[model samples]
Target: MMEPTAAVPADGSTARRIAPSRGPETARIARGTGKQWRLFNAALSHTPDFAYVFDLDGRFLYVNRALLELWRKPFAEAVGRDFFELGYPPELAARLQRQIAEVVATRGQVRDQTPFTDPDGTTRHYEYIFVPVLAEDGTVEAVAGSTRDITDRLRGEEELRTAAAALSRSNLELERFAAVASHDLQEPLRMVAGFLTLLEERCAGQLGADARSYIGRAMTGTTRMQALIANLLAYARLGEVGEAVAVDLGETFAAAIDNLTSRIAETRGTVTADALPTVRGDATRLLQLLQNLIGNALKFRAAMRPPVVHVSAERDGTGWVLAVRDNGIGIAPAHQERIFGAFQRAFTSGTYDGSGLGLAICKKIAESNGGWIRVASQEGTGTVFTVHLPALE
Candidate 1:
C-alpha cells in the first residue's frame, strides 16, 4: 500500500529536505514550509493506484511511477505528454477530455468507470477520480486524477448479473415444469385413489391377488412420478451461474474426471481426451456439463463389457468442439434430438432412474455460452454427444 501524503502548495512551500533554498530561513519557517509539499509529491508518487495531475488543457503536468508501469511505457514517455497523444483509445481520450472540461466548467469533481482495450490488447476495467483544482480567481486550473484498476470487481459483478438472470429464467422454467407435472399426475392420482376405494368396497366379498397387485403398481408409479418431479426441481437448480472466464478446458476436464474417479475405478472404465481449447464460459456450468455426459457413460453400460469412454476436443473454426463417446447402448437416430429435451427419455424408467433433466441442463448451458449439443449413435454400437463452445475472441 502507498502511504498517504499531505498536499503541497503550488510554490512547493511544505518541504525543504529535497532542496533547501539558502536565500532565507524564516521565509520557510513562517508556519511550516516547502518541505511538506515536496514530501506530499514524493509520497503520492509511490502509491499503488495511478495518479496524475493534468492542466485545464489536458496536458499531463505530472504522473506517478505506478501510472507509467501500468501502461508498460516509459516514465519519460508518459510525462509531459498530452492525454490525447497517449496510447489510449481515441474515443476514451476524448471522453476523458470532456470529463475534465465538465469539472473545469462546474468547478467540481467527477467520478466515472470505463473498460478499455489496453495497448497490449487486453480489456481492462478502471475506476477514476477526477478532482478539479481552482485558480486564484476561483476558476478551475487543473485536475488531479486517481485511477483504480477494477478488473476482478467488474468480472464478479458480471457473474452476479448472470446468476440473477439464470435464476430468474430457471424459476420461470420450474414453475412451468411444476404445472405440467401436476397436470399430468392429477388424473392418474385420482384414478388410483378411485380404484383403491373400489377395491375396498369390493374386498369385503371378492377382491383377488391380481387386483391387489394392480393397485400396488398404480400406487408405486404415482410415488415414483412424485419423486421424479421433486428431483427435477433440484436438478434444474444444481449449478448457479458463475463468473465467466477464459478457462483451459483441458484442466477443467481433468478436474471433472477426478470428481468421478471412484465411479471410473468401479466400472474399470478408461477415459481419454484430446487437448480441449480455452473458452469464455461459466466454470460451474462447464463442470455440470462434463459431469452429466461422463456420468451417463458410466451409468449406462453393456452387460458383457466394462464401460470405456473417450473424450476429445479440437478447434472448430470460430468455436471449440468436444465429444464424449462411450461403449453404451446408444440411441436410435430418430430419438437423438428428443433425448436432449426435458422429460423425454428413450430408455425405460427402471433401467435408468433419472429425472431426465441432465441433457436439458447441458443444452441450456451450451446455448447460454453461444454453443449447442449434438449426438451421433447406433443402437448397439455406441453414442457420442458433441458440445461446441464459441471461442472468447
Candidate 2:
C-alpha cells in the first residue's frame, strides 16, 4: 500500500483537487439579473401615470403607457414626434408650450396643473412636473416629466363647491329672513315700550317709585335686546354691504373723534395718530372701528385721570398693522380672549352701555379684508388693540 501511494508522486506539480462547481448557479443568476432589468424597464413604460423623457434640445424621447392612452395614438405614430409641435387641444398645447418654454428658459423645475381634452372630448386635469435630468458628466442631459390625472379630484371639488354654494345661498336667505324678522320684532317692542312710557308719564305721581323703577328696568332691557339684534344684523352684512377701499387711519381717527365729540369733551380724551398707512377696507367700517375703540378708551380711563388714545399704523410683511393704544383701566388677562368674541362685555351695563359687539365687529372687518386683530393688556395699566389689514397696493 505504501509503495502504491508513493509510486508516482501523483505528478505533484500538475495534479489538483476538484473544487465545487458554480456553473449552473452562475448561469441562473445571470438569467435572473437580465429578467429583472427587462421587467423594470417594461413596468416603467407601462406605468399608469404619464411619464416622459425628452432630449436636451426639447424633443420627446419616450412616453409611458398612460400618455399613449391619453394621446389615443399608437406608440409608433407618437414616438420621435416633436411633442411640442404635435398639436394637442389648442388650449392645452398653448399652456404646455408656455410652461415648457419657461422651464427651458430658467433651467429650473416647474410644476403646475393644466387642463387637456381627451379623445372623448371630456376635459381632464393634470398636475405635472418638468424636472431636469443629469448626465454622468454632471451636465443636464435632458428633462423627465411625470403627470398625474386629477380629473376626478377636480370634479369632486367642483361638485362639493356647488353644494356649498347652494347651502350658502340657503343660509344667506335665512340670514336675510332673520334680519327682516328682527326689524319686525323691533316694531312690536317699540309699540309696547311707547305705551308703557306713555302710561308711566300719565300716571307718574299716582304710581309708586318702585313701579317707576320697574318700568325703567323694562325699558332698559328692551333697549339692550334691540341693540343686540341690530349688532347681529350689522355682523351679518359685514362684507356684503361694505365696499372695499383704501382707508386712511388718520382721517378715520378724525371722523371717529367727531362722532364721539361729546364723550371726548366730557372725558377730556385726546386721540393722536401718525400718518397711518392707507389700507384696504370699508371706510365706514373703519370709522366705526375707530369710534368703538376710541370710545372704549375714553370710557374706561383709570379713575381721576384724563384719557389718552394713541392710534398708529406700520407696514408689515403682507399688510398694514394698526394699533389703538389707550391709557385706560386695562383688561384682565382672563377676559382678553373673550372680549373679541361676539356680544361679550366685561363691565356691566351701568358702567358701559353697549351690545358687547364692537370688538367682534372690528374683528369681522379685519378678517373680511384678509387680516385680523389682537390685544395685549394688564388690569389698570393700559389697553391696546392692533388691527391688521391688507395694505393698499
lDDT of 2 by residue, 1-393 (tens): 001110001111111122343587755654554455445446666667887766655556666667777777765566555655666756666666666666666778989997777778888788999987766876676677899989899899999999989977886887897789889988988987898899898999799989999999999988888888888788777746367888877788888878898998998888788887778888887787778888888888988789999898888998988899998999988889899888787776477788888888988777767888999998888999998888789
TM match of model 1 to true structure: 0.45
Show the colliding residue pairs in model 2.
none
The top-ranked prediction according to lDDT is 1
Give the alpha-carbon lDDT of every model: 0.77, 0.76
Off by over 4 Å in 1: 1-231, 238-240
What TM-score, over all chains together, does every model reach?
A: 0.45, 0.70
* RMSD in order of candidates: 16.9, 13.4
Can you tell me which runs of candidate 2 are displaced by over 4 Å? 1-49, 53-60, 65-124, 127-147, 156-160, 239-241, 348-350
Report clashes for each candidate as comma-separated counts: 11, 0
Question: Model 2 Cα RMSD, Å?
Answer: 13.4
